[model samples]
Target: MRLLAVLDRVDTAPFTLEALAGLLNRLGPAQSRILHVAPSRDPDYLSPDEGMPDAAEHARFEHTVSAQTDTLRQIAQEWTQAVIPHRDTAWTERVGDTRTLVAREAAGADITVLSRPSPQDNAAVAEAFAGALYDAGAAVLIAPLEHYATLGLRPVVAWHPSHTLDLALQAARPILERASHVTFVIGENAPMEVPDPPLGAELARQGVAVHMDRFLLDTGDIGEQVRQHALSAGGDLLVMGAYTRPHFIEWLFGGPTQDILAHGTLPILTRHAPLVRL
Candidate 1:
């Protein structure tokens, strides 16, 4: 898969490089591009009635932004070689909104990889990048700061009888094919009509050691149970379909898939259902 990784000047963490390397290694010799996006420094005005900044302040902000961009280029150069070992990998720099830039660049690529933002920067560039790519119909991989390569190929698939689950499996087919073991976790009280047995068998046919387990949660904390199962199974990556309903729709009608997304801590590989069929 052709993958594009967006790096922002403000988000400089060592784990970002490690995550890129891991993703490239997992994807084999696919074409990968590292793009550095310069963060805008202009203070956004809340309304038209708000006064503009003085000329001196605006010039200072512009100068600061230029300096930051230069620093970003240097950082990108250092991080690119460290993260992407292959000589064929290409790097570029762009000046614009990171979210918009990534969405445009990821259009033709099969997948996009993004590092999770630091807790202090929860609503930071990473979230914007993820939302933009996902909204653009690209498969996204969100990597945590922890060293994930040491976790090995054993993975846990959080399964539900939904199209999103199928999409996640399809997007993670490469990993699943190479995984030593795959554990499917399902709700104990879920309806018997759930058709995951065939899916499990299919994975087994692809050389993955597959097993299914059911969990009963009295506290109704299914998210906690899923996380526990993955950890107990020694999973390196957690595969799940991302729930993509409108905020209002989900608020009134609860979604276990959304709950899992909110609580999952492992590197999550997700694809929207409609994209999966493609």
Candidate 2:
């Protein structure tokens, strides 16, 4: 499997980098593509509405960006070596409006990995992650800030029999098929007995040893519910479908996906595609 791991600054210095390295180990020798998106000079970057200065400022900024890309390329190689040691990897840099590029590039990726976005995170990182998750046409795994030695070793699936869950399960098969222990936490939306063949049967067909339980308390607090259940069940990773409502709607009222991203204690695997977010 291959992953498009987008870096906000491509600097592998933070706990974010360490966390990514840990998640990479969990995937078991997969190819990695590193895409760096940031202003070359600083953490803060001005968007178009913020206004730009003269031609000199523009040229200088472009040069700085080019220089940073070179630096990031070197860093990508060095970090991957120190982290994964012997994994196939490639590196690239993106500047300016990268939404379309991220979507196109992530089309063939099994998963698009990004550092979990925080309220304090740069606006650029938030924009990139939003675009990637909404448009990548694949699952996106938001890596936590804490470094983990391994992920997906013991996994919990927050499941409800639906198209979204099916897509999520399909995307997570690589991890599911390899998990030592797998638990399925049936969310509030799930019927007592799935109408069609149970999801557990499908997972069984894929050779996943699994069990299920009900998750009904604190239904509004999806993140806590998933977190408590998974950790209690000894899971290292949490798998669930991505944003189902329009991104604007979710951002406005917040949703389960948003709650999980904000407070969940584990790495989250989410799948959404071709979002028509307004």
Candidate 3:
């Protein structure tokens, strides 16, 4: 597997790097790359509405990047050495459009990993996420804010029937096949009458141990409910579809995917559905 870890901020990257290393261990020896894409130098691109960065803002941005450069390198070196004992790894930083750069890099990767977005750096994070999942059509692993040694040992799938879920399951098959145990949290949208859902049945055929439970939507916030159940069940990773609704709509009204990204603590394996054209 080729794993790409996209860093949004030097401070938050340790968790992402940890998750990347853990995923490398979980998925077996693989090539991994750590990438940081800075925003384009063009002032217009940086602030389209203003059409340029004010002198003070420009100075602050440059200072921030300069100050973080050494720290970024140190963290990258540490993680690179840490992973080198088990697999091949490298790190690089580039200045460009985040979305385009991330999409280009992720195109060659089996899975792209990223630090969960924070309020301070959400724009860049969102751009990178869009580039990887939406543009490159790649599966993304959003690392938890907290550190985790490893994941996929016991992954919980938030299950429902949809094209998005189908893609997510397919992308996560490697993890599922290797998991010690797999739990399916059946959403209210799923058919309850069936003793075995298609996904669970397929995993069972593959000799993977599987379990299931009901997740009624009306119970409360779906994201919170899923997170609690997974944690309570000892789940180390969360596997589910992302962004079922339009991105703008989700940003405005909120959706389960957004809710999970904002507050859930589990490392999430997710993929967006392909865009349809008339």
Candidate 4:
């Protein structure tokens, strides 16, 4: 699968490069593009009391935007130099509006990888990118800040009977194909009704080493149990479906899906889907 990674600056967190490289290795040396998005200047810089001619303001705004674009181009060049020597990977950097640039770069890509930004600095960029890619029907891999470098081939699938499971698995197919081992953790409180076993059989056919375990806990912390199981199994990646229940249900019941999204430290592959019925 072709992988696109969005990088602005060098990541300071440990293992970030390692994780990215590991993921790239699994994808088998496809073209990797690093898109650098530049911030646009505000055209509303004129004083409210002053009535400036429309044409003059437009010309000034264009000049400022052009200068900013040039600066971003230089930054992109420097970024390319820093990343090129570190790996045997192709790198390219383009500067433009982040939203539009990302969409263009991701157009034909099968998957995109994004590093989670610090909470303070434009955190919405990553989130917005994730949603845009998801809407575009591209698989997105979000690397967490803490464990970016240590993700290996060992993975744990957080299974449920919902349709989200299928989408999540499909999005993670590249990793699953390369995984040395995969464990499916079934929560104890998950509906007593089990899902169709065909998916398990299909995974086995793909040569995945699959194991199923029943998670049991009386403390009502299914999220904790899932994390513990993944860690115990030596899994570096957690594969699970994204939000499954309705908004109100999630608000009232506190779904395990939300809990994992908020608390899980491992790299997660998630896909949105409708609820699956037996």
Q: Candidate 1 has which clashing residue pairs, if any?
A: none
Against the hidden true structure, what lDDT does model 1 obtain?
0.65
lDDT of candidate 3 at residue 227, scale 0 to 100: 82
lDDT of the candidates, in the order given: 0.65, 0.68, 0.79, 0.60
For residues 89-166, what per-residue lDDT tens digits would candidate 3 score against the true structure? Answer: 787788878889999999999889988876555477778877888888888898998977668988999876678778
Candidate numbers sorted by lDDT from highest down: 3, 2, 1, 4
Off by over 4 Å in 2: 10-29, 38-50, 54-74, 188-197, 202-207, 218-220, 248-253, 273-278
Q: For candidate 4, lDDT tens digit of each residue in 85-172?
A: 3544445545445666676776666666665444443523543364335444455565666744345488888877666667768868
TM-score winner between candidates 1 and 4? 1
Candidate 1 residues lying further than 4 Å off, grouped into runs, are 9-13, 39-43, 83-87, 118-127, 150-152, 190-193, 245-263, 273-278
Better by lDDT, candidate 4 or 3: 3
Looking at candidate 2, the ten consecutive residues that score lowest on lDDT are 38-47
Candidate 2 is scored at a TM of 0.79
Task: Give the alpha carbon lDDT tens digit for every residue of 1-278 in model 2.
Answer: 77777776544334445545655676677777888775543333356666655778777767877776777677777777876466666887665565666767777788887776656555566666656667665677777767666788888888755666677788887777777778888656644543333656766777777787675555367666777888798877888866565562354137755666666778787777454448
lDDT of 3 at 261: 75
Report the alpha-carbon TM-score of model 3 versus the true structure. Answer: 0.88
